[model samples]
Target: MRSLCLLFVTAAALSGCASVRTHQGYLTDPQLVASVQPGVDNRASVERALGRPTFMGQFDNNDWYYVGRELAQVAFGNPKPKEGTMLHVRFDPAGNVATAENLGLTRVVSIHPVGDKTPTLGRNRNFFEDLFGNIGQVGSVGQGGGTADNPTGGSGSN
Candidate 1:
């Protein structure tokens, strides 16, 4: 009984270390992808064979993309992509498939945003300044109107 209890605890601990694998975007089929021959298959034919693309080009309608990503997530952690594929299919002016290219995870680049603070012109004010700086500055003129300091109805200065 003692050994069985230890085994149960060990199994439980091991299970915590396991990560969940996930597949996102289009499910790739190698045979079907191979059957899509460039210069022969048009947009309609390709759609019939492989279904609609994951996304179309933003500016140009002739370019199609089929993106796939495999991610792994540990308990209480964010999911991270371990592998990914981007299939770029470009169509010619005649509407037939012109080229098909496969891009791998090696092309992936991650960009982290600077911070929550947005950069703007003028001086940076503190929390107290933001809360109380404009207390006595406002006048009866209202926004875009003139103040007592400047009767010309401008922003008090040139």
Candidate 2:
């Protein structure tokens, strides 16, 4: 009985540490991708060799991208990228492959957003000040036509 319990505990611990791999986008096969020759292959030929691309360029239609990502997650933690590939294919005006670039995960750039606080123009105010600053002042609920003397209406004189 003790041995069985020990085995169960060990299995549970190991299970929690096991990583799950998640794949996103197209996976480029090295050998197949290598078959594409710049200046020789066109859009249709490249598609036949490497399958459909993951996405196309935003502003232009000549650039094609085949992006692939592999992420691993353990337990309930967020998945982290382990490997990735971005294959960029640019076609010339003649529709022939002009350039081919295979970028790896090392080329990725990560931008972290600013913290919770947002900076505004005026001086900083506390919670009470924010809630009660306009308590005594009066104005139309959502309108901005209020004046100093007539807080809820347009300027008194036309």
Candidate 3:
């Protein structure tokens, strides 16, 4: 009984350390993807074959993208991409397929932010300065000190 209990605990610990695999975005079918031929396949035909694209181009509507990624995560760690596919389909002005390209994980870019606070080119103020910096600087509309409305600091006789 003690050996069986130890085996159960070991199995539980191993299960916690197992990596979880996830599939995100489009599910690619190599045969169907290869069937889409440029110039021969139009927008309607491509949509009929591959359903809908993952997303269209941000700037131009003529570009279509089918993105897929297989990610894996172990324990409490962040998920990392194990495999990725990006299918790009470009259409000409006449709506005919201009180009069809397949991309892989080579284009994936990992970005790390510099820090929590962004640095700016300005005066660095303390906590008190930030709280009371604008004191006695506002409500100068009628102080007669060369305001923006009356640049000459003269009476309103014009």
Candidate 1 regions off by >4 Å?
A: 1-14, 114-117, 137-139, 143-158
- Determine which window of 10 residues in candidate 2 has minimal summed lDDT: 140-149
- lDDT per residue (tens digit) for residues 1-158 in model 1: 99999999999998988999999998888888888889889999989988999999999999999999999999879999998988888999899999988888877788878998779987688999779876756764566665445555675555
Q: The CA-based lDDT of model 1 is what?
A: 0.86
Tens digits of per-residue lDDT, candidate 2, 8-61, equal 999999999999999998877999778878989999999889988888999998
Candidate lDDT values, in order: 0.86, 0.86, 0.90
Clashes of each: 0, 0, 0
Number of the predicted model whose lDDT against the real structure is largest: 3
Candidate 2: which stretches are off by over 4 Å?
117-158
Question: Once model 2 is optimally superposed onto the true structure by TM-score, how far is the C-alpha of residue 107 displaced, in angstroms?
Answer: 1.8
Name the candidate, 1 or 2, with the larger TM-score value. 1
- State every prediction's TM-score relative to the real structure: 0.74, 0.73, 0.74
Put down candidate 3 lDDT per residue, 1-158, tens digits, no spaces.
Answer: 99999999999999999999999999999999999998899999999999899999999999999999999999999999999999999999998899999999988788999899999976788999889876754655457556544566667687
Candidate 2 vs 3: which has more lDDT = 3
Off by over 4 Å in 3: 119-158
Candidate 1: lDDT of 142? 60
Cα displacement (angstroms), candidate 2, residue 86, comes to 1.2
Candidate 2 accuracy as lDDT? 0.86
Point out the worst 10-residue segment of candidate 1 by lDDT. 140-149
For every candidate structure, what is the RMSD over all alpha carbons to the true structure, in angstroms?
Answer: 4.3, 4.3, 5.5
